[model samples]
Target: MINVLKQASEGLLYMSESEYPFEVFLWDDSKQKDITPECVLQKVGLPVDTLVEVVELDSFFEVAIAEQDWHNSEEKITVKKYQHLVQVLKKYLFDLQVMRFGKINIDVYIVGKTSDEYLAGLSTKVVET
Candidate 1:
């Protein structure tokens, strides 16, 4: 778990799928390999007993991935879908900070590139609602 957080702290994104407008990806370096929100909370230093598990978020994500036509696509995110995900994360995991868009490395993967290169990029994307 520390390795995951260590990699994430360096600004390496965890990409579940690599297209563009990456869906099912976590830029915060807070996610474990399993990509469970519960694991995210755990990584952010939240105690296990206090976790308010939202199983629905996982289910929603699975549905979203299945519904999307991912064939040869570059632009992958819909504003509505992105916003909904942010809202859900905010609601369930308020303590964790959202990843800034400028911090995203375009070359995303499940384990990330293991570099903090994107941290030096522009902070054009607002993380707040």
Candidate 2:
């Protein structure tokens, strides 16, 4: 609750809702692709229900975002849909951050169910631009 860093680490972010003591690491393209849609699901530990987007970064890897296509599509999609929202789709190169390998926030856009939820268990207000 304090407006201070509750925890800090080298390239790792602290999250509250984590069931396991998890550390978040950015996808190192030097060792991997910008974002493999398949690997991202494995990293998130969720199954595919709906695909929200597929972003192609300028220098890094391409990202195919499959919305958490769970059985309970209604509830889950409500929460996951906003993550892959395209402010300008099909005509632009965008920057994306690996938000826990599951969730992601595109800049200049407030996505997800709500700001509090999207920014929840996150370090910065918005991903580093």
Candidate 3:
């Protein structure tokens, strides 16, 4: 599963106002019940007291990969690769959610439960000015 994720996320960058690479991670101890903002913080070794904002996966993607340059071949290819990555995640995981931790430069976790009920997905940083 990790290999599949690595392959799907290869060369894909999550673009906000800035571009960032997606890093795949697998939490062997994470369960389906641990798919909450609070749990996400702990899983990622963040302070439990830190604030976290939950955003829907589709909404996050729509903004992250917003249409910028349809005519540019490189941009077009990147967009398609991101879309494909999303599809791959959906195909392999369930109960997916986007967890945004902090303001300005936010830590984003696009996480979901694997077939074995463990948390597995990609994490990235998004700088919003």
Candidate 4:
């Protein structure tokens, strides 16, 4: 993940259908055209018993070199090493909620700074109404 992030940190990373074999995407806000950048930053720290598990990836790729699997599925996350990132993201947003909006939802804590990166690295299109 660090290597991939490092590469993406420099510029955008694009994946073709041969790379991530995703057939289709159905978004809830397909018509929404803009996403307001919330000033709040939520940081989720390391491995919490409460977070979505980080799935075991097979070399981060499988099948004719094309894959569309949700990598972070039901796998358990161990706090042996990766606990800090999650904590930083989750706690940051939690504090942001109390300080700014007085309420923070689960989505905010999970998305963190990755929201921008996710949208950038992935090949999916956005159609914000």
lDDT digits (tens) for residues 1-129 of candidate 2 = 111112321232222233112222332222332334454545445465423344332111122123444546564443343223232221122224333222443211111111121211122222322
Return model 1's CA RMSD, one decimal.
13.8
Model 4 is weakest, by summed lDDT over 10 consecutive residues, at: 119-128
Best by lDDT: 3
Per model, state how many residue pairs clash.
0, 2, 0, 22
Error in Å for residue 61 of model 3: 1.1
Please provide, for model 1 over 1-129, each residue's C-alpha lDDT reduced to its tens digit, 9 standing for 90 to 100.
323333322332223334233333334543333434344344445445542323333342454434355534432444334444434443333233222211233221222211331111111111222
TM-scores of the candidates in the order shown: 0.23, 0.23, 0.89, 0.17
Q: Relative to the unseen true structure, what is the C-alpha lDDT of residue 50 in candidate 4, on a scale of 0 to 100?
A: 33
Residue pairs in steric clash, candidate 3? none
Q: Which candidate number would show the highest TM-score if scored against the true structure?
A: 3
Could you tell me the TM-score of candidate 3? 0.89
* Candidate 1, poorest ten consecutive residues by summed lDDT: 117-126
lDDT of 4 by residue, 1-129 (tens): 333433322232113322121111112222222322232221213222332322212222222133235434322121211233233333332211111111211211112123322211111111112
In candidate 3, stretches whose alpha carbon ends up further than 4 angstroms from where it belongs are 63-69
For residues 99-121, write the lDDT of model 3, one tens digit per residue. 99988899999999998899988
Q: Which segments of model 1 are wrong by more than 4 Å?
A: 1-77, 98-129
Query: Which ranges in model 4 have alpha carbons more than 4 Å from their true place?
Result: 1-5, 8-43, 67-129
